[model samples]
Target: MAPGPIRVAETPLVSYLLRRADDALVLGHRLSEWAGRAPTMEEDMALANMGLDLLGQARMLYAHAGEVEGRGRDEDAFAYWRDERGYRNLLLVEQPNGDFAVTIVRQFLYAAYAEPYWRAMMASGDATLAAVGAKAEKEMAYHVRHCAEWVVRLGDGTAESRARAAAALTELWPFTGELFEVDGTDRTLIAAGIAVDPQTLREPWQRTVIQVLAEATLEAPPAGFMRRGGRSGRHSEHLGHLLAEMQHLQRSNPGAAW
Candidate 1:
């Protein structure tokens, strides 16, 4: 006999899916901001493609979450309607894209974590989520490679480039801890085998990051107090501005369609 589908309760499942969608949505927007201003035209295209990929992933997750929540909201509603406090994206993604080095560093850190995360998520009891994870894993592999290449290039480049990369790493490192923090939602999902625990991604992510830093001849910043609370809707000031701009078109003409 064939195995039955792994059933996930609506509440925790919906919340977890929303968090996943929000992370992708926010990061995609951040990457898209580099559309015309990248260091090179080729880089400009690369970032745009990556941004689109993330946005697509977010759309799928949001749609699934909406179905799970039994809400009238669709992907557009979730993406454009929610205020910053209503969003559950990690703080690391909402940080400003400081400069070329900063952007590359952020992408590298996130890709490193996400690649492993999605790989683990492929085994989720939720078949829809598992399928999504399988597809995203392929994209994330490329993302990780692209960002890692940039990190190596910048870190081993001119003195100025190396210093900038280091500075970006220092500024972003503290926020990474929140990526691995487990909360009640994660615990519930983990118990149901419907979600991968973020905590398990940390050590492997660290090893991967450390190896890349070594190859780039860069030093890893000392671990310190990690910021948390993005999962609970407490976001930094930057997210509000991002939301204002992102939701402008939709909010300005409510119910308008292309």
Candidate 2:
């Protein structure tokens, strides 16, 4: 018999973990959208592989969260049964993949932060989280390298590609600020040695971004107004559309599996 739904408490720790999982899941879906639409066959496969990596990370994180919550909620439950407001992914990730340049810039910016964030999490007090960090850090390192190479290529290519890359940078730069926004949830877990301090990651993240942009011959846009609220269950309209598409199969046919 199938198990009934489990009532899970949204504790600070669970929220923190879900935020991470949601980030991976949403971004993975975005990458998956490029499956057959990429500029070349090699890139098409590469994006698919990267998407799979993020999905794998999300599964691990969601499983760990279910365990910590002491609930029967598995990865599938947390992934498919949640409403838009129930998600806690960063706004940057949930944004629509505008163009090839946009997708590359978005991935590069995110992987830049994710690489260091996962590396720092390797020292987490929680054993499961530490193990997750070890695996994810390596994947994120590769993501950073792949996306950075694309960013440079796009930025330094022909006039149209350069313009597109520059436009992508301008559009995506404002969303990067939310990556390092620390809050009460972060503070509580940081004290417990269960979370990496987002503030501490900012310097390393910026250094990587600057170096990569320099190589691409693209200038980093000056910081101005930044978006927020994804951690608090608030997201742009894009998330709702994404959730509708992503959750359709599972929502329409509950418990149906291959």
Candidate 3:
């Protein structure tokens, strides 16, 4: 007789959702920081809008994860109560926003991965996950367009701008590999048709990145040792400092809602 289907623990699913939520949340915060600091007022507003879109996606994901875990924790609890070590956001998201070029390059890389990832997730067997994926995919499409335009504008612009764009792309390329690294959580869900295998995204991600770089007149960076461990809750030191600021109000005034 054929073997029965493998049953994976619900915990892995919850963990997987939380990791995706954390990525959106942390990156949203980072993007919001550019609100008043962008090169122009129009760009400032654009970044702020995109940031809020990502935060909205996180809120939905966190709520769904809470339900899946059978935990009483709510979105606020997950967002405000988790310590640095508890966060599973990609190190790429938590990395310091260096300059305008750096921010655009980072966003471009993430959008390239996210747009396709969400498109795949829209077919998930899990209804809530599929719904969130649908909504997020729309928002990510806009983000991808915006970031890609910036990449091209800067990369093919004046000599100095092109140099800066190239430098940012090279600096951020290493982090892109982590987005495709799968773990046990991924394996279980992928088998169940409830999640996309991240590995499947690598080829399309590379194709998209290379095409955009070509349009921007930028060369692809050389591959090197890929830094990882973010999904395993091991993050760079920058996350600790970011969390301290992000959780300050909640930690200081616990349960003191207005």
Cα lDDT computed for each candidate against the true fold: 0.89, 0.92, 0.89
Error of 3 at 169 (Å): 1.0
Q: In each prediction, how many residue pairs overlap at the backbone (N, C-alpha, C within less than 3 A)?
A: 0, 0, 0
Rank order by TM-score, top first? 2, 1, 3
TM-score of each: 0.95, 0.97, 0.95
Position 160, candidate 3: lDDT:
93
Q: Could you tell me how far off, in angstroms, the CA of residue 232 lies in candidate 3 after the best superposition?
A: 0.5
lDDT of 2 by residue, 1-258 (tens): 444333458898899889999999999999999999999999999999999999999999999999989867889999888888889999999999999999999999999999999999999998988998999999999999999999999999999999999999999888988999999989999999999999999999999999999999999999799999999889999999998899888888888899
Error of 1 at 67 (Å): 0.5
How well is each residue in 1-258 modelled by candidate 1, as lDDT tens digits? 432222333488887998899999999999999989998899999999999989999999989987887756678877877777778899999999999999889989998999999999999999889988999989999998998998999899999999999999999999999889888889999999999888889888999899999999999999788888888889989999998899887777776787
C-alpha root-mean-square deviation, each candidate: 6.4, 1.8, 6.8
**Regions of model 3 farther than 4 Å from truth:** 1-10
